[model samples]
Target: MEAVMSLLVGCFFAAGVYLMLSKAIIRILIGIVLFGNAVNLLIFTAGRITREAPPVIAPDMDRLTGIAANPLPQALILTAIVISFSFFAFLLVLALRTYQELGSDNTVQMRVAEPEGDTLPPLGY
Candidate 1:
């Protein structure tokens, strides 16, 4: 099970990186999401895979009876998820604004908006 999970994590990371290097804005967004999932998987694996063990302490179960997966990674993942979600939302809004202003999603063609003329009218003349 560990081996399988490790392989899956590796694949997801690879896919995410592959998408991240693309020139398309949407692909980059997808890559970011994929990378987040890969990170979550890596943390989950670090917590150690286990069968049927609850992380919470219970009076009925002895410590020796079953080894539980660490809860710390889950909590970490949850916090990371929330932060990443906000980042993703912000990125989407930013991207939309970029598209609206630039009129293109191609990274190569996109340019920062610049005022056409260099000279400006005197402020208080």
Candidate 2:
């Protein structure tokens, strides 16, 4: 189980990194979201997977056969999810603005928009 969890985390991280390094804004946005998810998952996995019982305890129950899950990871994940959502929303707006300004979603075209040749004003002037 631990090995599988490690593999899953590794896969998510690799995919997120790949997407993040892409030139396309949409891919980048997705990458950021994936990265956040990966981090949350990794943290959760680190804490260890526990029982199926509800996190809250009933006073009557004397003992639980299985170990209880660490609540910190759950809380961290919830916080991360909310933060990631806000980040995704912001990225979407940023991407939309970028597309609007560039007139196309191609990053290469944007790169070429800058003057490359003898198009600059004199340095002193």
lDDT of 1 by residue, 1-125 (tens): 87888998999999999998999899999999989998988998888877756666668866546566677988999998998899999999999999998898888767454344556668995
Task: For each of the candidates, give the backbone clash count.
Answer: 0, 0
For residue 40, model 2's alpha carbon misses the true position, in angstroms, by 1.2
Measured with C-alpha atoms, the lDDT of residue 89 in candidate 2 is: 93
lDDT of each: 0.84, 0.82
Model 2 ranges with Cα > 4 A deviation:
52-67, 111-113, 116-118, 121-125
lDDT of 2 by residue, 15-82 (tens): 99999898787888888887888898898888788766656666887666565667888888899899
